[model samples]
Target: MRRRLLLSYVSLVVFVLLALELPLGLSFANAERRRLTSDAQHDAFAIAVRTDLELTPGSIRGSTALRAMLSKFAARTHDEITILDSGGHVVAATAGGPALGADLSANPAVQVALRGDDATREIEASGDDILNVAVPLIAGRDVGGIVLVGVDLSGLSHRITSNWLRLLVLGGIVLAVVLLVSLLLAQSFTRPLHELQRAAKRLGDGDLGARVKVPEDPAELRELAESFNATAEHLATLLRSQQSFIADASHQLRTPLTALQFRLENLEDDAPEHRDDVGGARREVVRLSQLVDGLLKLARAEQAAPPRTDVDLRAVAEDRCAAWWPLAADHQVTLETDVPIVAVRS
Candidate 1:
């Protein structure tokens, strides 16, 4: 019972944690992803505005300035930047990026940017997760070039993983505390029941004084214990009253049975022709005395509440058969005994 109660408590706690934490973790992950994507798109558009002013038609003077700006921005933000001409060929890029003059038109973000629209996507490049944002560079009502920004997502993934781990650890702590509290609660509930069980066993074993202690808290259990105690007290009082009555009745009967036997014995000497009658009357008086003795013994045994002991059935049978042999011989009957050597609690 205690185990079942504890299991139920732990199960409920687990269900509540799952219901609350699962969606919370997912929401945090999605929000983080969106925030990072928005920052990347903003950076891509900022670079596009600057690049639009740098690369004018038939202007070679701005090439050095553009490369210097791209390198500085890439170094500070740790993002890869690539500039593509209107024909989809890379003109300038950050160090370790796509080579200059390399065609990247087949790239989805590049293709979308070439169509004069902004594009954002998440992709894997060189075994690393990247969030790519592309925007068109406006050059006097025509597309001058494309500005592409690739943001590394390893840090974001790490942040999300760290948060999830923290949540898991918190859940574990909560579950541990719940398990301990549940264990204590279960014990508190079952301890009273265990005491009641022991008391009932004692009462069943004839210890009529056995009783349970009522608890102060938990009104229902207290009431149950009180009821049990009341029942036991009433039963004990009834049995004691019965024993007293049986004792008094047996005492009252013994005097009459003894007097009857004495009168019958005296009649035998006074009348020889009535000897048979006197003998029969004397036997009946003896039987009555034995019955009274039996009743007294029963009352005393009830008060004593003696412990049971093992008795050998074969020994008992042999003793009884021997004691009854003379009576059987007088009746012209033979006494035979067949008993197995078995032990039983008396």
Candidate 2:
């Protein structure tokens, strides 16, 4: 019972944590993705403006200066940068990026940026997720080039994983605490029942004094315990009264039976012709005395409440037949015994 109760409590807590934390974790991941994407887009627009200025019609510098700026921006932000001309050819790229003069028109973000518009997308590259932001460079009322920024999303994934781990650890701790508390509560709740069981067993074993102690809390259990104690007390009192009555009745009956047997024995010598009658009366007196003795023994045995033993029915029947043989003969009744041996617990 305790295990079932504790399991129920823990299961409920786990379900609630999953219901609340699963959505929270997913929301955090999505929000992080959006924020990172926005930052990447802002960087792309800023680089486009700078590239347009550097590539102005009378500029003294060439692609060397543009490459240096792109390399510096890429190094500081840890992002890959690519500059593409309006004809869909790469003009410059950071180290470890696509080769310069490479055609990238087939790329979705590049295709959109070449048409003088901003584009953003998440794509998988080299077994990692990459967020790409592309913006068009304005060159005097015409599109000059495209600025493409790629941000790795491994860090965002790690952050979200770390957050989920923290939530799992917290949930585990809460469940552990709940388990401990529920165990204690379950034990407390069932303790009274255990006591009642033991007391009932003792009472069944003939311990009239056996009783349960009433608990102070949980009104229903307290009342049950009190009622058990009251019932045991009443039963003990009743049995004791019964025993007292049996003892008194046995004493009262034995005195008169003994006097009657003495008178019947004394009358035996006074008349020879009435000898048979006197003997019969004496036998009845003896039977009555034996009955009174048997009753007293039964009362004493009930008080002791001894453990049972095997009794042979055949032996009991033969003894009963022998005891009533004379009475049966006087009544002209033939009592025949054909008893079978059977063992029974008493």
Candidate 3:
């Protein structure tokens, strides 16, 4: 039960954390991507501003300076920069191992930039994600080359992973704390129930004094404990009263029966012919005395006096059979005794 309760608490916490953190993590990733993309677009436009001469057709002198500027910008921004001619051919690039002179017209962003539109796209390259931003170079309403900047998602992915890891660690700590608290609470709750169960068992086993300590908090459980103790005490008092009354009545009745037997004996001496009637009355008085003695024994037994010795049922049965043998013979009935020597509680 404790394990189940603990699991229930942990599961609820995990579910809530996941529900909150999953969307939050995704939003954080997307926001970071947009911010990075905006910065890249700004950088691309800045580069395009300085590359007007390079973008002009047949401008050879500015090409060397443009390459140097692109290199510096790429190094500062950690982004790959490429300059494409109006024909969609890569003319200059900041990245090493460049695809110089490569026909980029097939790419959607390059085609859009060629048509004088700024374009941005996310694409997969070499098993990694890359963000491509294309800024068109406009030369007084005439189309010029395009400036394309590509940013790898590795850094973004790393930052996102780092954030998720931090959240995971924090969530783990919270769950641990919650688990500890749940365990402590479960112990607090079940401890009282365990005590109550033990007290009930003892009470059922005739230990009327057994009781459980009531908890202070959770008023309902406290009331229940109090009620149980009260009921046990009441039952004990009632049973004790009943046993005492039976014992007292049996003891008091024995005195009158003895006196009546004495009077009968005196009457028997005074009247000899009525001897049979007196004998029968005397026998009845003796039976009544025996019955009263049995009642007193039962009352004492009900009082639960601690046993001092074990009784053998086989010996007791044999003695009872022997004692009743004469009466059985007079009634023409057989009295049998076939019991094993079993020790019985007194």
Candidate 4:
């Protein structure tokens, strides 16, 4: 039963940890993803300001300086870059694609750019996030083109997932520590309980001396130990009382019975035909009287409430000894008193 309880407690701890960890780690990942997305959008907005007039790929023609700068920008950011012309066609793309004549008018970002709306659109294209920012390029008072940028979620989400695994590892470490501590505490508590159980079983099987070893730790366990000791103490006391009662009852009846036996032995042997019958009657009478006295004493001890008196048991023994002194002298038997000075059982 104790083992089951321990398992239950540990299970509850695990369940709660899972309940807390799953959602918390997922939220952390999502928060990081949001930060990544916002940073990507901000970078796209910056590009839009710089490319407000031409689809010249943030540079003039295929300038080596422009290519190097673009390469550096790609190396430093997670956002994907693309340029579109006034015809709503892709003029250039960072993914090494011919963006020169690809129609972009039907694209939501192109529509936003043509309408002179600085707009943004997020779409999933082939499992990649296309965060299109349609900021119209203005040439003197007219729109020239649109600059579109995309940020892929797969890579950023992978990073978020990596950090999540790390969090789970830390949580596992914490859970291990908790379990170890619980184990030590449970052993400390259950050991005493197990001992008490064994002791109780022993007492039930008539070993009244059985007792639990008191625990030193945990106040409650110590209290249980004390309670067990008290129970054993009471049981021993009751058992001793029963033994003393039996011994007293037997010893009390022995005296008069021996006397009656002696009287029976002294009956005449030379009597007539009626001698055997008369002798039997007298012997039965003596035996019956002794039995009656023993029964009466037993009945008195078993009463719902016994009489209480200040009778000194040893003093009573001494008085009985005095009464039998003359008889002991006649039989050449010595009378002696070896009673203790202190009080004793009745």
Candidate 5:
């Protein structure tokens, strides 16, 4: 029961943590991704506006200045910058790997920008994500080219991962605390029940003194403990009253029975002609006396039993037979005793 309760508590805590943290973490990561995308798009649009200003026909000076600006922006942002001409050729680039005249028109983002639509996407580059933002460069009614910006997503991913790990750590700590509290609560609830069980067992085994101590918390359990104690006390009182009555009745009967036996003996001595009647009456008195003795023994045994000891049944039987031998002779009967030496409870 304790284990089940603890498991239930931990399960609830885990569910709550998942419900609260999963969406929060997902939203935080998505927000970070959106922020990166927005920044990339803003940089792309700014570069396109600058390039548009220098897009005049037969302007080599404008192209050189644009190249210099692209280099500086790439160095500062740690992102790739490419300016493509209307013929889908790269006009200026910060990195030499793509070359200045490389045809990048096959790229989806570039193709979308060439069609005069702003495009943004995540692309895999060497096992890491890169955010690509593209904007069309237009001067009046003529399409100059496109500006492509590619930003590394490593820093964003790292920040999201770090924040999620912190959340997981916090969740773990809360779970630990919940586990501890659940165990304590389980113990508090079950301990009293265990005590009550033990007390009931003792009472069933005839220990009338057995009782449960009521706990302070959980009103129901305390009430149960109190009820058990009350029942045990009442039962003990009833048994004590019964034993006292039996003991008192037996003692009271013994005196009158003794006096009656003495009177019968005197009557037998005085009236020889009625000896058989007197004998019969005296035997009845003896039987009554034995009955009273038995009642006394029973009452004492019920009140307080002596510690157990082994008794020889053969000796007990022989003693009983010897005691009844005079009665057997008066009745003109032969009494034979056959006994075995066996151990019996006394």
Candidate 6:
């Protein structure tokens, strides 16, 4: 049962940390990705505004004439490059073939430029996310077409994954540390309890001397140990008293019983003339029997323990006085009791 409880506590901690860390860490990572994507879109729009263009049928941002300029601007940005014309055809693309000269006017991002409005979109296409933004080439208020630039999101995804891995690692380390500390603490607290268990088991096996080791200070655990020790002492005392009672009873009765036996033997063997000595011997035997009875009562005193009921001290004192009243009248002896009715103390 204790093992189950320990496991439950550890499991609860693990689940709680996972529940809190997973979403919080992911949200933070996603927010950063979104910010990066937004920045890429804006950068693409600015690049479109600055580019030199012609309605001449040419590669988009891929034109040999503008490649140097586009490369110069897009270099080190991790942004995918693209150029769109007034007819909304992709004239150039920095990524592989399928992306080149693709019609983008129908695209939600291009539709905004077609309506003469600047627009941007962060989209997943060809198993990759692209943040695309478009701007019309305004050659003196006459729009030649649109210059569209695309930014790839692979790096963002990579960063988010890396951050998540770090968080998971940190969580694992923290959990391990917490569990180790908890185990150590539990052992410290449960050691005394284990000791108590052993003592009780021994006591149950008829070992009355079995006792807990109690500390001097009266802390809770110490007090419990002391109580158990006290119980053991009391039990040992009772057992010893019982043993002494048996031995003392035999000792006290043996002499009288022996005398009785001897007198019986003499009465059976002697003639009628011996009857007088037999009668005196029988009287001595009776006196011995009375002494034996008194000794028996004294032997039984070993079994006496503190009574649960409260006894009236004054009543006991008065009873003692009454017993001596006749002696007091004859010899004028008196007994007094001024002690309180208090329990015995060490």
Considering every candidate listed, which one attains the maximal TM-score? Answer: 2
Error of 1 at 236 (Å): 0.8
- In terms of lDDT, the poorest run of 10 residues in model 5 is 55-64
Global local distance difference test of model 2 = 0.84
Query: What stretches of model 1 exceed 4 Å from their correct place?
Result: 58-62, 257-297, 302-346
> Which segments of candidate 5 are over 4 A away from where they belong?
58-62, 249-346
Question: Candidate 3 versus the native: TM-score?
Answer: 0.77
Cα lDDT tens digits for candidate 1, 1-346: 9989988999999999999889989999999999988888888888877886786773212298889988988888889999888877888899989998889898889888878899997889889998889898877667778888989899999999998998899999999999999999999999999999999999988888899999987999999999999999999999889989999999999988888788888889999898865776676677678878977888888444566789999987886676666668889999888988899998
What is the total number of backbone clashes in candidate 2?
A: 0
* lDDT of residue 43 for candidate 2: 85
lDDT of 6 by residue, 1-346 (tens): 4565568668988998899898978897879877886776677666665565534443233457666656666666756666766677766655442355577777777778766677777778889887777766655555556767676777777888888888889988888987887787667666777988998888776677788777554388898998898888898888778768765886868776886768666784775777645555565566567667655655554333422556676665665565555556678766666867654331
lDDT of 5 by residue, 5-122 (tens): 9999999999999999999999999998888888888889888878878776522223678888998888787789988887678778887436877898987788888787899977
Model 2 earns a TM-score of 0.86
Q: Using Cα atoms with residue i matched to residue i, what is each candidate's TM-score against the true structure?
A: 0.80, 0.86, 0.77, 0.65, 0.74, 0.65
Q: Give candidate 2 misplaced runs (Cα > 4 Å).
A: 57-62, 260-304
Task: Please write out the lDDT profile of model 3 over residues 36-92, one tens digit for every residue.
Answer: 999999999999899986654532223789989999998899999988877778889
* Tens digits of per-residue lDDT for model 4, 233-279: 99788866876776677677767767776665555354555565546
lDDT of 1 at 284: 60
lDDT, model 5:
0.85
RMSD of each: 4.6, 3.3, 5.2, 13.9, 5.6, 12.6
Q: Write candidate 2's Cα lDDT for 53-158 as tens digits.
A: 7666422133788889988898888999998887767878899998877898888898888777899988899999988898987676677778889999999989
**Candidate No. with top lDDT:** 1
Candidate 6 wrong stretches, greater than 4 Å? 4-12, 52-65, 95-101, 136-143, 215-219, 257-346
CA lDDT scores, all candidates in order: 0.86, 0.84, 0.85, 0.69, 0.85, 0.69
Error of 5 at 324 (Å): 12
Q: Higher-lDDT candidate among 2 and 4?
A: 2
Rank candidates, lDDT, best first.
Answer: 1, 3, 5, 2, 6, 4
Backbone clash tally (model 5) = 0
